[model samples]
Target: MKFDKSELQIFANYCVAAAESMAYTLVRTAHSTFVKETEDFSCALASVDGLTFASPRTFGATWYVGLDYGPVIRSLTDYQPGDVCMTNDPYSGFVATHTPDVVMWKPVFYEGEIICFVAGHIHNTDMGGAVPASLSRTLTEIHQEGIRFPPTRIVDKGELNETLLSWMMCNVRAPEQNIGDMKAQIACLTTGERRVLEIVERFGVDAFKAGIGQLLDYSESQSRAVAKTIPDGRYFFAEYVDEDAVGGKPMRIALTLTVDDGLLQFDFSGSDPQLTSSLNVPTGGHPRHALLLVGLNYVLYSLNPEIFLNAGMLRIATCEMPVGSVLNPVEPAAVGMRSLTCVVVQAAVFGAFAQALPDRMPACPASSVCLLNVKTTDTSGRTIMASIGPVGGGAGGSSAGDGSDASGANMAFLRNTPVEINEAEVPIRIQEYGLVADSGGAGQYRGGLAIVMEFKVFAPNTLVTARNRDRTLFGSWGIKGGRAGRTSLFVRNPRTADQDILGNTDLVACQPGDVIRLEGNGGGGYGAPFRRTVEAVERDVRRGYVSRQEARERYGVVYEDGRVNAAATAALRADMAEGPVEANAFFDYGPNRSAHEAVWTRERYVALCQCLETVSVGWRFFLKHQMFDRLAERIAEGEPIDGVQIVFDLFAELKAQFPALAAQQARIKQVA
Candidate 1:
């Protein structure tokens, strides 16, 4: 069968429709709330070479699309009909599908030759790990996190591999749900395989392959055209994660973007060293995960919204990550909570582009994905567990307008998980859920507002895992004179009763009637608050996104009786003098790269990072911070007046004296 241009277009549409249909089936039949309600899954078709050919237009996987399935595809070369290759090892190329996501890949054959691959990924409720839910911020290694599968064939020649199935069942806590979802993913791929074969039968294999190439080529061309429109230049930006979760040491993410001649390069050479925490990112030919940058770029450019997301879009871009860094961790590194790092990575990219294209880019958005896992037992003493929908932060203010309320920047497509579903599934009650008024940064174009959610635990010994609790110092920073957004707050109660502040944790056992309130961070504002129009301030007050006090203090506008007091506002504005914008007032988790440079001196901090290359991942995080803190303490004590350089020099000398450590340092430097 041969497909002409017209037929090729029709076939392409059909393929996209098939993928969407498969996703719909999985969602309707899936067991988890993350999949059914939040829709945190994706299905796509890949060429025999592992390049994505077609993906669903509606649903987006965090790090699954734009991925090259070469490793998984190659592992399944011997696979016959009915064979399914499955893996969630972030290191082997399935980047950070560590838990929740069980990826399934099935090869489509034509005339006894592999022609295409159908892959579907769904977020399972749980995969066996140390914690009840899969995400553990304290996981130090992959073994402690969950079951590991290297590109193994779970189904052979249409037969289920009972040995592998048994192993999975033994490992996971919710074996039934996991296995059921696994079968659901397989069914999705099977649907895609059937659709692809139908197209192959209608159009000859040669024409089908040609259409794939044409579609890829078209996407590549459009991406390059958009890239060319932006002025070619180099941009540098950095963002920090408050900590690595297990420890209080801030992690640095430095990015340099060099765009020239329609080619964009992202270099992540100066990122912080990998930690023992579960925040590490696994590395492989992660084309899909890496294409997160490309997807973000597309959203920023607001290009033709439909380029048919494929591997071709990445042809105009490339990413350079240093091995053993947090962004590209080595083997055995835990990545259970990798999405936390991804939010920061995306912000770093946005920050870099903001430096280059401030007019086109908006101020920094509140970039935290709040995941809360509630675990308890039912009346029968059977364990009951549920993962609440991940809460999204507000979008940053853009040049044209202020940010929206309780929305994510660059990812406005995602929606909040409904309270009804949450109430029905978990042992909790939603006391209050709404937007945090006056949380958005004040400016001419204010940033989006953050969300406020309060929940009461109904079961005894309920375990709760709340990540990214506060964003005060770590909250999104504004550009120009725009003020930073209010940092996130996790409080038990406020102004009335005893309330405990929550920290990022692997688990928290709670008693019944304990209330947990989450106040998310808002995005940074774009321009001066006083410059904002009176009408905008009035609108914010009416909408309950801003209070009258904020209107007068921040925006220099007065609101009375739901109307802006124009004369008072003018007088306030006239009385206010141009001054430095308020700096970010938030908690510093620990010594960030910037703070390290500032507090310990840039040269000293650089020397410490160099020394860190010599030590093991575990020891470096433990000893270096202690040593730096000790040195700072000594300095504060006025102990090193005469022999300051000697003290530093002696420490360096001792580090160099260890031959094994020196050799390890050499190896690390060579690898880096």
Candidate 2:
């Protein structure tokens, strides 16, 4: 408020420009294609208190608006001017949710005192692990994924620590690429430092400092105003992930959102326990850990497009996560596939808001990603290690419009790694890459189609590691009479008669000329399929997004020669008879999920999860696996089993064996 309107505008513009410039430097100097092509990086300018006050709007990952710098910043007691701290440890000062993302922070000083900090986060190509890419869906612990770093001063007082840098390189397979990427992070930070200094020297340090505080306050106010508009009440929604990557049994996530007086609280106490798989999210019990509110802030930003986005938005909501739950797993738990978990959190938040603001929300989003790594050999007997893709998943339908196509709505920041780059870098040929036809759920506003991609191996003995894969069983649910999106599929040798469906396999060895393909299911629809116009169905058929038979069956539409047969369509629609919907069926989750829920009702599942707390932490994985395997067997045998009693027996057996854990059961939901 101290400066005039024009002066304030100038300061804001300068900060944004500086952030964008930092991102530009990172992309241009980056060694890994993950940074240059996929653009999996973020940059921001934080005040001395470690609150992000400025970040680029059009560049970098957009989730930092929810990140916390206090945990890392408060621990740096020995910092000096020009010192840079580097970390990738999720439990340490890395602040990143996973190990693949290396975060670097450099202090920006003015008048020999720190005024602000510039930070950059980039995902390295590899960090030496059980698998090549350092991220495996089946990895049981974080230690197996890669070497981790605490907040170490890699650059002290303007001098690079060569010894420390070399030590980090010793743990990774791609030393040159990883170190180069780390240097790129430092370069971005240095660029930001120079830009911030320019602002301070031009506008004076006092004015620059005041401007930073004002900008943060301004962003916070914008968030508060938006929250204030929503009705004050409690909203609850329970959703399920496809499977606990180690097995095929579905996992559940419960959300309770309370909005009162322009403030929000998100609670995840009833969610399933932490898995042995790598899909857990180590949120460290922080409400504003940057990943929890990715969807909420996305909605907020969409509502107020011109509002400023930064850590100040963290002031909008508070979260309470049960300890040992999948979202708040203890240290050393594998958190490589956390983005998949985040997709559920995002959906849950959307569901909560839909209760208050249905017009603003979309149908369920297709949730899953496929990133495959191939290790093969060339003609000269030299081995070539390469990657396939972090394939884009389809997004859900919206009340305002149709959902996004193959590019996920929540992950619009992620771009496909180009096909040309993959072919050039490794011994694989692109057999097919296109949209999956008739996969999207039908609605008045149809859901977008999923992208189907296939590749053929060219080497004799190829080791293929599926770094992250999911959505093999249950699919995205629809809302307000919409249908559920189709689930994801991973197939091996799809072109041959003896094709095999891997069903989200973790790792495998493929021989020469083997083909593998992935079908990322489309987003769910937003309304009744029969309500869709005939013209739209005809166009969909023309574009190969919908088959003619599917158009007639799902939509009750008759089209010929790319034209709507009005008389025939009317008669067909009049006689169309579909299965009866359940009582007040606002959500249509398709048959697979509906069938699963028939046996694993909300009360039964939550009670079972709570009882499992009596089992010791070390034995919980095996016990849960046993329970799910039994349930899967019953489903496979076309028989109904007492899921609640099955869990009770499992818990009672484990508790009786280890009576010491019986008392620990009281600790369940203590954090709630």
Task: RMSD for all candidates, in order, please.
Answer: 3.9, 2.9
Over 641-662, each residue of candidate 2 has an lDDT whose tens digit, in order, gives 5656766765676667766666
TM-score of every candidate relative to the true structure: 0.90, 0.93
The weakest ten consecutive residues by lDDT in model 1 span 585-594
Give stretches of model 1 more than 4 Å off. Answer: 1-11, 60-63, 285-301, 410-415, 467-472, 493-496, 560-563, 575-577, 581-608, 614-619, 631-672
The best candidate by TM-score is: 2
- Candidate 1 lDDT by residue in tens digits, 551-582: 89999987677677789888888776455433
- TM-score, model 2 to reference: 0.93
Candidate 2 deviates by what RMSD? 2.9
Clashing pairs in 1: 1-204, 66-288, 67-288, 100-124, 471-475, 472-586, 473-586
TM-score (C-alpha) between model 1 and the true structure: 0.90
Candidate 1 C-alpha error for residue 545, in Å: 0.3
